[model samples]
Target: MNCVKTIVCIAAVMGASANTALAQHTFSMSSEVERVENPLLTNISPGGVTVLRFAPTYAFESRGERYRSRLSLSAVIERTSDTTLLANRDFPSAGYTWGYAWPSSDLELRANLSESATRNTQFADFGRVTVDAREREFLTGARWNKEMTERTRLTLNATNRRVDYDTPLLEDYRELLLSSRVTWDHSETEAYYFEPSHSRLTPLNGGAVSTQTRWLVGTTRALSQEWSLDAFGGQSRVKGAQTETGTLGGVRLNYTGSRLTSGLEWSRDVAPIGAVSRYVRNELLGVRVGYRLTEGTSVAGRYSQSRSTDVATGRGSLFALSLDNQLAARWTSSVGVEERRSSGFGGLSGRGWAVRAGLVYSYASGL
Candidate 1:
């Protein structure tokens, strides 16, 4: 079956079994205006462009003795001063999740389905350059977890994902992945885990299928009430039109206090680039800090740097700062500034800055 059919079937099943004692519904709406310089990070226009965006979301949830289910729908409406730069004006997204637990068997099951579309690539795992195309994705997955002993557990997961672009600049692909993990609680302060997975990626426009196998081991340690650390290392092997093997790992440290929070993270891994129909190894480092200035105000800042192992792929850095304030009982506002610089990537390198301000209104009640 196709992704749409699968998602519909899952939604039907969840709706049919929605006879629960505890149920709730929620709705929220938000609007924002942003002025960005070189919005596309290209030389097309060097002047600032203004953008207005509106977003609204709705969600329904139900819970029984041993099972819970949730469904959500959302949409984005946008207008840009330079319509030629960004074409798509509206985007719709949906998601559904259902989970159940068996106390007698010490087992739990969870399933999720989601669909989304976006024109932003800043957070995309593969793409660093801003493109003029919209990327749409469909994903469905299920997870199973079993408690084998007092201090040991096991988990299994399966997923299917598909990606498509509005333009031919990027290739469309479908991927299937199966993975398993085992965990052991060594002590009250530390836990360790091992995971292995395999995935197959096939291009829709006709090409050889790429397969990847990965093994990872990691541990989480709670150093103190306010400080914690997590570290993981892994190896990946890929086979298809081209073959390669590489090592990947990541580490993170975090701290939390009554009014202060900070974190540092670094990672290196192989990422799939559908545009090129291949994978590249990249490294990333990030630092973030946040402070509560007053009872209803807070400030946060983050810095991130990323570079590919291949010189031709290029590198980039971004610095961002934001301030958030509670304006009323159900209203909040935020203002942010961001600066970015990039080099390489076949003439896709440039520097830019942007400023944004937004307001959000939220309300919730039991149904």
Candidate 2:
């Protein structure tokens, strides 16, 4: 998506909101700074780095009891100390969402459109990149839901996404997805769901075109007022130059209370490899817990384990931990450490560790 296009789309939505009655607007600004050792988390070369970031956002929301709509615009500016490894980046994102439901009825309709541009590097984007690349994406989607019976509900959704990259070496693709879900309410605290989806991935550079069809069965249950569990398991069939099928599923357990919130998850899936002709199978496990020390202060930490392999790249794992604190109403900071170790093609060899500290200040107000 082009920056101009995002701006124009946001402008159009804002203009349309003017005719709607009882609309509210909000504005927020946030600034952050981080100091890091081995910033990119790469196994090859590590260096000390500092990063600065600023983000400003504007949002307009409707205040209807049933019918609702929202338009939001966000922009980001980032600067890094070591341009040779990690360059400066900027991102501009805009989105419009609208939903409607009838009073005392069990039917709903929703739609969304978004455009965004980003320039950055992420270690989890499959591999480490020595240079920064720009990417743009456009998304449009719609969903409908209806009550099938007193104990059941059905929903259908469709989405289209386009991704473009400034680096011609990276593949650009358009994705179309269609899905349906059905949920059965066994009780106030127990529910089960069945979901099926179909997706088509078409490459713009004459690469292999892939299609996937998948189905999942899942359940959600409240163990208690403050504890819950969600679990799902499924399988997917992929068709392309090479046909492949694999198991795909995940499970999550969560806790919610007055002063504590935590979650644990495990997943396995087959995902399309970026700019590559094949797909990779990934297995991941993660858990996070946080406790509020006071109204304005909290402490949290997280750990995750992942292993992935494909025809082109080997398996790798990443471990990370952090301590976070909310100093005041609008001020927050965190100290973190992470290590990456791998022993495969395109994977990290020796273990590399990085320590980081960051502070963020944000202010928000109604417009």
Candidate 3:
């Protein structure tokens, strides 16, 4: 079957399979490219980077009265490049992920597994390069969510990770994390979610042991028809680690109107111990304006002004603008620009601009 037809079939089966006592399967695919106008190669220089990502996914959901099952599979490839690093240097990584969700009365069970492999080269000297090899990692986890009462809920999750490198210069590693959360929702508009998690990290050959204890709290409230707020705070203590304690807090104020949804947020976050997607203490004021230009097409403009007190080491100011046009019928297109300026601290600082334009084919009907 063709791609568009396949997508339509997959989405069509989702709702019915979830409600019926039958099982069903679905699939999806996506590709994306994000290029940097000027990348930072030596950690403090201007360079160019192009990141390409491709993903294919499959999902299955079933209902069996007292027993339920949901399965997901994903394959992804990620690659990054710098024309100056090695004249044509690039690193590619492939990863696969699987997830399962089941139901049992007031309790639900969930588990996920993932593995990834990476390969790349680095510049060491003016004429010398280090042939560091690929790195491979595996992760698996399970979680249990229980409804303690009509107003309260609790969850417990545990995960373990293992890592290996193709080069002996790099060593193996292992780690585990035990996390839990409890939430009390007075209603849809007002709620709080709290979490306490413990983690430990150690090298493959019993090299070093690092530990952490963390607590997080989240809250949401609707002030009025056009205004709402979301807030969260977290505290963590680390042992055998370079850092001692870290705390984080953030708040987002949102406004809605006939043609726009605007939000402003201020946040202070700590650096994760591992390679997780995160940023510094970021503050942002953003707006989204949507106009029904035509019966068949709609236009949206989004702009944001943000600042980052990179908790890791520096300060940065950024401005971003995105323009999107959607054919209420068949296609979607977007154009965006991002300009960044920062204080060159921690040896990582730059002033540059980047632009991107993309088009995506969508179903004639909503998915």
Candidate 4:
């Protein structure tokens, strides 16, 4: 949702001080190599190819007793990757963000300003390319996370973002979303979160406008320093009789150490459309393990499986595996493979595999 955009903007400006800091500022570069295979493989076919890529990240942040600030910058470049069963093309991206926040007497104010530009071609079909789609979003919000009683605390938040997308310029959606999230913080270990948000979609094309409403409720249990459990459910109702229902429930168990962490999780989701549509259910199982092999190197891997069901699409299953390595302080590399089998019209026995690698260079400092 638009919420992710809001969070990333803040993280960019506050730099990395909110969680971790790397001695004023840090920079690094990395690259990846890949190989893929598919039934449609050909000499120049979408069968699979190998590719090399690069990325760079730079950031600097500061923290004070009552104030914080950050600036984050990033860029990525890649060309005709040979390790993927996809098309051959070049794609690059960059972003800039600045943010600040201050705490006032009974309330807090946070502001973010960000601008981003991206251009890339779709791999499968060359005709349907995003000729031009860029976005400039600004967010301002206030929040309260104080205690009203010794046993309970009521939290509230509100935010606004102005978004602009540019391309052929035929269609535009400058939507306005306003929401207030309230939570009953029973204690540090037990809390209940409830949020109700609404959005109004105004078409720049001057067509009929639409509105949507969403309601969510969630609970969290902090079992220990390295383990937690969460459960949440939400519903989205459109302007018409169209409605979407979602349910999320998950349990996480992890063992943590100074240099190693491992976790296992399971989740289930169900979505049913109101009208002439389909009902879908997803069952997921995941496992993750990470180890800091040395001061400058670390390794991690994950495995996941999912089974989905629907009306028209019938049923499907997906299995994926991935591994990541940290090198030379500034270099991070990863490779992953995923296979999916599904049934539908024109559906054949097929699978897709992706192998990716990239290099990045970063430089940042405080003035």
**Candidate 2 clash pair list:** none
Q: Write the per-residue lDDT of candidate 2 for residues 1-367, one digit (tens) a residue.
A: 4644664565566457555656777776767666655544456556666778787887877745566677777877878888775567777777776776764233333333333222122235343333246666777778888888899988988888777777766677888889999999999999999999998888877877889999999999999999999999999998888888889889999999999999999888776544463456667677888888877667777766655656535443566667768777777777777666544464445345666676766665442
lDDT of 4 by residue, 233-279 (tens): 77665553345555556566677878988888776654322111223
Q: Candidate 3 — which pairs collide? A: 39-47
Name the regions of candidate 2 deviating beyond 4 angstroms. Answer: 1-24, 40-42, 103-122, 125-132, 277-279, 312-328, 333-335, 340-343, 350-367
TM match of model 4 to true structure: 0.62
Best by TM-score: 1
Put down candidate 1 lDDT per residue, 1-367, tens digits, no spaces: 2543565467668768667878788888899998878765564556777889899988888888787777776777888888775553676677777878886333333343333333245333432564656666777778888888988889988888877777677788888889999999999999999999998888899888888899999999999999999999999998888788999899999999999999999998876665655556778899999999999999999998887755227677889999999999789899999987766666656777889999998877774
Ranking by TM-score: 1, 2, 3, 4
Top lDDT model: 1
Worst 10 residues of 2 by lDDT: 114-123
Q: Tens-digit lDDT track for model 3 on 229-306?
A: 999998877666355776767788888766666677666543222221121233444555565555445555555444
**Model 2: how far is 58 from its true place, Å?**
2.8
Q: TM-score of every model?
A: 0.91, 0.85, 0.64, 0.62
Model 2 has an lDDT value of 0.69
- What is the clash count for each candidate, in the order shown? 0, 0, 1, 27
